[model samples]
Target: MTQLVLHTHRQEHILRLTMNQPENLNSLGFKLVAALRASLQEATRDDAIRVLILTGTGKGFCAGADLKTMNHPYAPGEPDVLDCIVELFDELRNFPKPVIAAVNGITAAGGMELMMCCDLIYAARSARIGDAHCNYGIVPGGGGAAILPRLLPAAIAKYLLFTGELLPADKLQHYGLVNAVLDDDQLLDHATTVASVIAQKSPIGLRRTKQVANEALDKSAADAIIHERLAARDQFRSYDYREGINAFLEKRKPEFKGY
Candidate 1:
């Protein structure tokens, strides 16, 4: 089967993108990253898809980059592994619709970086998460240093990076990194439910909300408001905006065509 599988049958508007490699814990080798990026790009162009859930098959969500594969010298004209990682994260963070991480198992090093890119995360109770780069005398090049601190307290983030110790899902959830910690069997179901709920909302509203909120993370409060105002003004002109208003006044569900 393909290393990456994009499933749209579970719901009309929710796309479930799964890493199909269970061996080596679905490591982010060149092929896997390339495959994932392709799928994300496809989702972006497909208006029918409004939400995404990223997860892995078997026991791991992603165990970072496949160091064995990465150990080889880069061929001439080939992008480095770090470059692929950066590209992947950029796509994840900038994805217009909400993306949820359904972490199933061992999540470490670059694996943690992958999970951090999602808008929300729900992990199995037995999942372990952390930055393990320091343990191997390496530092993270996948935005772990920058992203972890934003998701967790500075002190806690520092400890994880300095020690390379994996923490249980419950611990990270306490730090507000993981949105929910659930039994292994419940992880995907909960993520699906959340994605479905989000998919039911106005696509125009969802896109604008996501774009503005993500931009707010990097801007001053004043700048963020200015951005939001501009985005809202544009959104108010969309067909979905009129549909939403008409649905509200007519007491009916909006049939959003994602315009």
Candidate 2:
């Protein structure tokens, strides 16, 4: 049987995970979700991996949950689809390393939600993105409904949610949802170039920065400041922090140990 997810080490510190069920547009089937979750767990524990890139093979980044299995009867004690989706997304959202979503093609509904979980989103010019749940009379079980509004303006979010219309990546970039839109042929190269830069930074600094930033979203302004201050103080105690400062003074590159 073919692998549900393909794992490639783009560099020593960069991992690219490609959803491989192109025949079904890489839909989030049970096996695919399990594979992705397992990959994420392994990446999280591997200190050498400092960045992750998520994409898909063939014509779709992801078409969302496997529709054919949506209403099927479950086997005894089988995991609920929504439960699995929630777990996978939660892992993505809280992943310590930076994740870049290279949206190469059609990304709809939960596919878009998965992209949103990444730290950065770079889409191909031909990539179509939207909350397509409405097209199938399905309510979004992912962040399409809740977190999307926070990511984009309320009106724009509502339009995607209500219409189920797919928008070009450039259009979403105009709304500040996508970090950049590149030509189809340039998407992966651009994503890897960006990830390579991030990989050179202090790993602990990036992890702490991500932690503080994600937490700040749910915090009040004053509380966010305090949280950031505490996080910074903690980070200052790390070896990478001192190495960074000394490296600058000595005009040499910092050798970060990811401590």
Candidate 3:
């Protein structure tokens, strides 16, 4: 059987996960979701993997959950589709390492929610994105209603949610939804380039920074500052911190071991 997801190591420390199943527009199926979740679990435990890049193959990134299976009645003891998606999004949102979404093509509904879970997003010029849930009369169970508003202006988010119309990648970038929009051929290359730069940073430092950044979203300014201060104080005592300081003083590159 063919793999539903393709895992490729890039620039040594970066792992690129390509959602396969082009025939289905890389829709999330039972096996595909399981494979993705398993990969995330393994990557979290593997210190050598410092960064992750998520994308899809063929003309579409992800069309969202497989509607065929989604509408089917679940067998006894089988997992609920919403529950599985919740678990997947939760794992992705709390991922310690940097995760970049390289949206190469169509991204709709849950696919858009999945992309939002990443730390940063880059898109191909030809990519189109939207809530798309309204079109199918399906309510978004992932981050569409919740996280979308926080990520973009309320009006813009609502527009996407209410209209169910697809917008080009550049338009989303204008609304601050995407970090950058590159040429179709340059999407993966650009994402990998960014991941390579992040991979060279201290792993422990990146982990802590990501943790603090995620926390800041829900925290008051003063509270977030306090949290950041505490984390920084603790980070100052780490081996990687000392190595970084020493390396700077010695005018040499730091070889971080991720502590």
Candidate 4:
């Protein structure tokens, strides 16, 4: 049976996830979505991993779901099509480790939702992006409607969804969808540098901060501040946290075992 291909690599505290379907521009599909969910679960369980960076191999970050595969017979109790997409998005968004999307090429439709799930997004200067569901005569059934507004301004998100038009990488960088844009030749190098910076930080601190940030995204300012203070209070009491604080005071680099 055909399956989604993925590549994994771990270097100390960093976990790199690479979509390995350059042949089809890393299109998402039933099997691919399932595989991604399993992979993220495994990543969360590994104490050694402090950061998770996602990218695609070859020329395409992801081209959204595989249109050709939609013809297959569905299971009797399959998940709601929209729910299935949100599951993947949620997995990435709520990951304990920092999640970064290295958008190296085309990202369209569901692919845009996947990219938006990451906390930080680094796009290749040549990448093209969009939500093209309306062009197919169906509204976007993925989490883009809910996720896009969280990532960008309401007017821009609506414009993109309504028109189903492709936006250039530079344009998205200007629009704030992309955090960093580098020349295609420097894309992987730049993304790796960002991942390394995350990996070098205290694992416990990074995880707590990421969790707090997610929790605060939708909360009132006062509640969010309280949530952050409580999370920090709990996290800073950990053994590794104490060590990190001491290391900072001593003017030395932290050596975190992800405790």
Q: Estimate each model's TM-score.
A: 0.95, 0.97, 0.96, 0.92
RMSD (CA, Å), each prediction: 1.7, 1.2, 1.3, 2.0
Model 1, backbone clash pairs (residues 3+ apart or across chains), number: 0
Model 2 Cα lDDT, one tens digit per residue, 118-212: 99999999999999999999998888999999999999999999999999999999999999999999999999999999999999999988998
Native-referenced Cα lDDT, model 4: 0.83
Residue 221, model 4: Cα distance from true site in angstroms: 0.8
lDDT of 1 at 45: 89
Instruction: Order the candidate numbers by lDDT, best to worst.
Output: 2, 3, 1, 4
Most lDDT-accurate candidate: 2
**Full ranking by TM-score:** 2, 3, 1, 4
List lDDT for all candidates, in order.
0.88, 0.92, 0.91, 0.83
Off by over 4 Å in 4: 1-4, 80-82
Worst 10 residues of 2 by lDDT: 1-10
- Model 4 RMSD in Å is 2.0
lDDT of 4 by residue, 96-158 (tens): 888889899989898998898898999998898988888887667667787787777899889
